[model samples]
Target: MTESLRWIKSSYSDNGGQCIEWAPEHANTHGAVPVRDSKNPQGPALLFPAPQWSHFVEYARKQSV
Candidate 1:
């Protein structure tokens, strides 16, 4: 089920190994965001509500500054 979802890494993620991927399409279609470690595609995914996910991303962006 997870394999069918398209995952995208953060643009800020380089080849440095630490990376996470999220399925935005899944969020749009299902109203929940699926996030997982990019290095572990076969691993478990953490689902978050769209609004919570948006807030998380926003907070992350602010913290990066």
Candidate 2:
């Protein structure tokens, strides 16, 4: 099921050892964002409501500023 989702890494990920990937398509189609560690593609994923995911992204962006 996960293989069917289009997962993308954060643009800010600089080939770092630690990275996170998210599926925006899933969010749009399922009303929930799927997030997972890039290093553990086969591991469990965390699902966040679209609005909550948006807030999390906005918060993360601000933290990097």
Off by over 4 Å in 1: none
Clashes of 2: 0
lDDT of 1 by residue, 1-65 (tens): 69999899988888688999999899999999999988889999999999999999999999999
- The C-alpha TM-scores of every prediction are 0.94, 0.93
Whole-model lDDT, model 1: 0.93
User: Model 1: what TM-score?
Assistant: 0.94
- How big is the positional error of residue 62 in model 2, measured in Å on the Cα after superposition? 1.1
Q: Stretches of candidate 2 above 4 Å error? A: none
Best prediction by lDDT: 1
Compared with the true structure, all predictions reach lDDT values of 0.93, 0.90
